[model samples]
Target: MVTAPFNWRPHSRGRIADDGHGSAVGPQQAVDVEAARAARRRLVIDRSCRVPCLVLFCSAVVWLLAGTLLAMIASFKLHEPRFLADFAPLTFGRIRPAHLNVVAYGWAFNAALASLLWIKCRLAATPLRGGALVLAGAGLWNVGVLLGTLAILTGRGHSTAWLEFPVPAAAMLYGGFALVAIAAVLSLAARRVRRLYVSQWYLLGALLWFPWCFTVAFILLMPAPVGGVTESAIGGWYTRNLIGLWFSAVGVAIIYYLLPKLTGRPLYSHQLALLGFWALAVCYPWTGMRHLIAGPLPAWAITVSIAASVMLLIPLLAVTLNFHKTIRGRYRLVGPSPTLRFIVFAAVCYLLVGGQGVLLALRSVNEVFSLTHTIIGHAHLGMYGFFTMAMFGAMYYIIPRLTGREWASVGLIRIHFWCVGLGLALMVGVLTAGGIIQGLELNRAAAPLGHYIDEHGLSEGVGAFLSQLQVRGGAVDFLDVTRGTIPWLELRTLSGMMLLAGHIAFAVLVGLNVAGHSPPRPGPMLLSAAGRGRPLE
Candidate 1:
C-alpha cells in the first residue's frame, strides 16, 4: 500500500498518471506528480487574487509614510511642546489622532485585507470571485481613510479612541469593508475542498465579528450617543475588540498558515488549535472592560471583564505551545527565509503582549499604570510588534508568488528587520521604565518638611512639596519629577525616526519588486552561504 503524503489535499484528484498509465508508475512518482498539479492549481487561484491584493498593499504603503510623518511630529511635541504649538492642526491632540487613524485603518487593516484575500483563495482552492469589486472596495477604503485623517486635522474628530472617524467617513469604511468581505465569503463558499483548514476558522470569524463590533461602537459613541460614563465603557470595548478579535485574529491566522508550510510540519495538536480558537471567541469580547477597572463603570462589569481578561491566558498558552512545537527543530529556516523569521518574531511577540495585557488588567496594576505611558507601550507592542510584523511576513511570502519575482535584496531585508526590532525595543523599554517612575511619583505623598522655600524663595513648605509630586507637575521649573520624562520621550522620538527609516526601505523594496526589477530565482532567498541549496525547512 502507498502511504499518503502528509498535508495532501483530499480533493486533489487530477494526478498526472490518471490517464490509464498509472499501472506503470511507482507510488512515489505518482505522489510527486499529484503534488505538482496541486501546486499549479494553487498558483492559478493565487494569480486571480493578485491584482486586488497589490492595489491594497500599494495604498497601505502610501498611508504608512503619511502615518510615520505624523508620528514623528507628535513624538517631537512630547518633549518640545513649543515646536509647532502655535498651529492648531499641528498640535499634539490633532496630530496624534490622525497618526492613529491612518496607521490603524489605512496601513494596518489594508495590508491585513491583502493577506486575508490571498490566504483565503489558496486555502479554499478556488479563484477569487468579484475581483473588480474587491479592487473598488479597496479604493473606497483609501478614500475614507484619507478623508477621515484630514477631518481629524480640521477638528472634526469624534472623542472615541479607535472610532474617531466622522459618521460619513465611517459609513464609507463600513460599506467598503462589506464589499471586500463578501469577496472572501464567496470564495470560501465556492471552495473545492470540503474539509476546512485551521486558518479558515480565524479568517471567517474575523470577517463576521468586525462589522458587528464596528457598527455597535459607532452607534454608541456617535449618532446615538450614550450619556455619562457608559460611553467610556463602550469606547473601551470597541478598541479592545478591534485589536483582539479583528486584528489579532487575522494576524494569528496568517501565523498558523505560514508556520506549517515553512517548517514542513503539521501543527502539533489539533485539539490545542481548537481550544485556542474557541477560547478566544468566547473570552475576548468581554475582556474589554478591564480597561475601565476603577472608572465610573459598574462594579460587576469591571469584575467580569477582569475575570475574562485573566481567562485569555488559556488561548495565549495554547497558541504559544502550538507554534513552539511546530518550529522547535526547524530553527534553521529562519536564517534563509525572511518570511519565516518575521513570522516567528511575531509569534513570540504575541505571547509577550498577551501576558502583559493580563498583567495590566489587575486592579492594583491598573490603578498605578492607567495614567502612565505604560499603556502607550502596550499598544505599540500589540499593534506594531505583533500585528504589523505578521502582516510584513505575509506580504513577503505572498508578493513574490503574485509578481513571479524574488525579493530585490536580502541585505535590505536584514536592515529592515534589525531597524524595526531595535527601534521597537528602545521605544517600549524607555516608555515602560519612565511610566513606572511617573506612576510612583503620582501615588506617593509629599515628604515631611519644615520651612522649605519655593523656587522664588517663598516659604510654603507643604504646598511646594505637594506640587512636586503632582502628575503634571512641571509648572514651577524643570526640576520637578515629571521633568525626568523628557529624556525618555526624546529617546522615543529617535526610535520613531529609526522605525520611519525602516518603513521607507520596506516601501521602496515592495515598489521595486512590483515594477518587475527583480527576477524569480530557483530556490528560496537564504541569508547564509551553506543554506542556499538545502530544501526548504
Candidate 2:
C-alpha cells in the first residue's frame, strides 16, 4: 500500500538513531528530525512558488472585484432596466456577457492556474522551474482577459456563449495558456515522486482537456464558422466540456488535495478516488450533447448525452462518499479552519450541482427549463457555488503558506463566507422557483395561442384577432409571462448586493494579508475561540 507523502508518522518508536560518537538518539528525536526535514522541503517548494502564485492570485482578485461589479449591474438591470439604460456599454446584453467572460477567464482561470502551480509543485516534491515563463504567461493571460472584457463591453464580442471573446483575444488567451501548460508539463517531468496521486491525475487531465476543447471550439466557431444547428451544437459542446472537463476537474482536484491535507488524514479510499476519476473521464465528454437536446441535433446524440449525464451519478457518488468519510471525524476542524469550511461547502455544492445536472438533462425537465432563469440559476450554482467557492478555499489555504503570514482578520473571512453563501443560495433559490413559474406560464400561453391561431386563422386583421383571442380567454399575453418573473428578478438583485458586500470583505482580507499588515504567526490561524494559539498536532 502506498502511504501519503504529506502525512508523516514514525513506524516504530523502538528504532533509535546512532549519534556520531556511537551514542543512541531517542526515537522521538529521530522522528522530529524527519518531520523537520519534511517541513523544510515544503518551505522550499512554497518559496519557489511564491512569486508566480502571488501574481496570479492578485490578478484574480482584481478581476473578481470587476466581475462582481458587473454582475451586480446586470442583476439589477434585469428588474429595473432603466437603472443603466442610458449607457450603451452598460446595457444588459453587453454587461451580462462581459460579466461572464471576465469572471470565467480573468478570475477563475488565474486562480486555478495559481492553485495548479503550487499544488503540483508540492505533490511532486519539486521546486518550480521556468518561473519566468510562468510569469510571462500570467501577464499575457491577464492582458488578453482585459482586452476581451473591453471588447465585449464595446460590442465586439462573438455570439458564442463561452467563446464570446473576439478572435484576436482568443488567440492571445491560447498563447498565454500554452506557456503555462509547458511549465506544468516540465514540472511533472521533473518530479521526485514516482507514484502519481489522484489529484495529479486530475490536474494533468484538465491541463490537456482545456487546450483541446478551446482550440477545436475556436477553429470551428471563429475562423471557419459552422452554419445552422451545427453551430449551436458545437457551441453547446464546447461550453459543457469547458465547465465539466476544465473548471470542474481543477475544482475536484483541489478538494481531493485539501480535504486530506487540512484534516491531516489519508484519503478514505484511494480506490474510490480512482473510480471517480475514471468514471468522470468517460462520462463527462459524452454528456455535452445533452445541452443541445430538442434542437436540430440527432436524436441518438441527445440520448447518448442523457445517458452519460445519468452515468455521472456513479462518479459523483464515489467522490461524495470518499470526501465525507475522509472528513467524518474532523467536523469540528471545519468551524475553525476557513479553508476546510469553504471546501466542505464547495463539496456539498458539487453534489447538488451534479445531481441537478442529471435531472436537467432529462428530456421532460429540459423541455421546460431550457432558455429560462432556471438554467441561469443552475449554471451559477455550478460555477459560483462549486468552482468559485473551491477556488476561494484554495486561495485561503495557499496564500498564507506562500507568504509566510496568516490572514489579517478572521471576522472578514466569516463575513465573506456567510454573505457569499447566503447570497448565492438566495439567488439560486429565487431564480429556480421563479424560472419554473415562468416556464410553465410561457408554455401554457404558447399552447393556447397556437391553438387559437390555428382555429381562428389570420383572416381578420392580425392585431384585432390577437385582441379578440385575449378577450375570448383563448390565449395569454407574452408580456404577462414576462411580468411574472419580475418579482424573482428583484430578489436576485438583492442577492447580488449581498454578494458584492462579501466580495469586498474578501478583497480587504486578501489585501491586508498581501500588504504584510498581518504579522506572521506560529500556528495555523483557526476560527475557534479556544484554539487561537493551538498548534496542529
Candidate 3:
C-alpha cells in the first residue's frame, strides 16, 4: 500500500516559539513563509508545463469554436434540412459526426491532456517530465483530429460512433496519446510526494482506461471487423466506456481537486473519495452495455448492464456527499470564484446526469427514449453540462497561473456561464419533451406497421405497406411525428446559437488573457467585484 508523504502537513497558522537559528517566528510570519513556499513550488510546476499546456489549451479553444459552429450548423439542419441542401459536405449526416469527433477528440481530449499534465505535476510536487514529448504529442493529436474531421466531412468517414476517424487518423491519435501517456507515467513515477491524492487516482485511471478502451474498440472494429449484433454491442460498449470511464473520470478528478483548493477546505472524508473512486472504476465498464438495452443483445447482458448502472449510484452519492460537505458553509465562495462556480455547477450536473443515466438504462425507459432526441439531449447534458463545464473551470484556474495574467473581463465570464447554462437547460428540456411526443407517436405507428407486416408476409413492398399504413385508423403517421418535433428542433437550434455565443465570448476572453491585454493579476482572478483584489488561500 502507498503511504502518505512525510512532509505532508495540514494548513496551519500556529506560532513557533523558536527556530533552529535561535530566533522566534510569529504565527503570521510562519504562515507567510509556508504560503510563499507553496506559491514558489506551484510556480515551478506551472512554468515547467507552460509551453505545452498553453499549446494544448489554445488548440482546444480553436477546436471548441470550430465544433460549436459545426454544432450550430447541424442543429439548424435538423429543423431546416433544406438550409444547406446544396452543399454535400454541409449535410447533416457529415456535419453531425464531424462536430462530435472535433469536440470529443479535438477540444475535449486536448483540454483533458493539458489538465492531466498540470494536475499531475502539481499533485506529484514535481516539474513536468518529458514536456517536449507532450508538445509533440499535442501536434500529432490535433493534426489527427483535423484530418479525421476533414475525412468525415468529405464522406470517407466510418459509421462508428466515436471511432468515426479513418484508420490512419486513428493510428496517429493512438501514437500521440501513447507519447503523452508515457509522460504522465514518467511524472507519476518521479513524484516527490509518495502519497497520492484522490485526483491522482482518477487521473491515472483515466489515462490508463482510455487507451485500453480505444485500442480494443479500434482492433475489434477496424483491423478485424466483428459481424452482426456483436459489432453493435461492441460499439455500444466503447461509446459508453468512453463517456463513463474516460471523460467522466477526468471530469471528476478536476472537481475533486478544485473544490477543496478553491474553497480552502479539506475534503469531507478521504474514505468517501476512495470509495467513490473504486466504486466508479469497478462499475462503469460493465455499465456501458446498458446502451444496448432493447437491442439484439441478450436479456442477461442488458440485465447485467442495468444492474451495473444502478450500482453507479454508490459512487455518485459518495462524490456528491463529499463535495456537498466540503463546501457546506462555503457557498459564498461560489459567487466570487469563477473556478468554484463552474465546478460546483458541474458537480451538481454529475449527480443529475448520473441519476438520469440509471433511469435511461432501465428497459421500460429505454423503449420510449431509444433512437429519439431524448438520448441526444442526455448525451449533451453529460458531455457539455458536466465535462465541458469542469474543463472550463480548470482552464480558468490554470490559464492565469501559466500566463501570469487574469481573465480580461468579469462580464464575459458571466456571459459565458449564463449562456451555456441557460442554453443547455433549454436544449435538454425541449428535446426531452419533444422526444416523448415523438416516441409515443412512433410507438403508436409501429403497431399497425407490424400488423401489416405480419399479415402480408415479406413479399409486400414498402410502397404498399406505407399505403396501407396511411388508411389505417388510430395509426399515427410518420410525417405527423416528424412535424411534432419540428418546433422543439427549432428551439434546439436557438439554444445552439446561444451556446455558440457563449463559446465565442470564452474564446475572446482566453485570447485577451493569453495576449496580456489585462493587467497582471496579483493573485488568482476571482469573479466577484469585492474578491477581485483578494488573494486565494
lDDT of 1: 0.81
Clashing pairs in 2: none
Worst 10 residues of 1 by lDDT: 14-23
**What TM-score would candidate 2 get against the native?**
0.90
Q: Could you tell me the TM-score of candidate 1?
A: 0.89
What lDDT score goes with residue 197 in model 1? 68
CA-lDDT, candidates in order:
0.81, 0.83, 0.83
Model 3: CA > 4 A from native: 1-29, 444-475, 530-537
Q: Which portions of model 1 show Cα errors greater than 4 Å? A: 1-31, 445-481
Q: Model 2: runs farther than 4 Å from truth?
A: 1-30, 445-476, 530-537
lDDT of 1 at 524: 66
Clashing pairs in 1: none
Candidate of highest lDDT: 2
- Cα deviation at 417, candidate 2, in Å, is 0.8
True-vs-predicted CA distance for residue 182, candidate 1, Å: 0.4
**60-91 per-residue lDDT for model 3 (tens digits):** 99999999999999988898889988999999
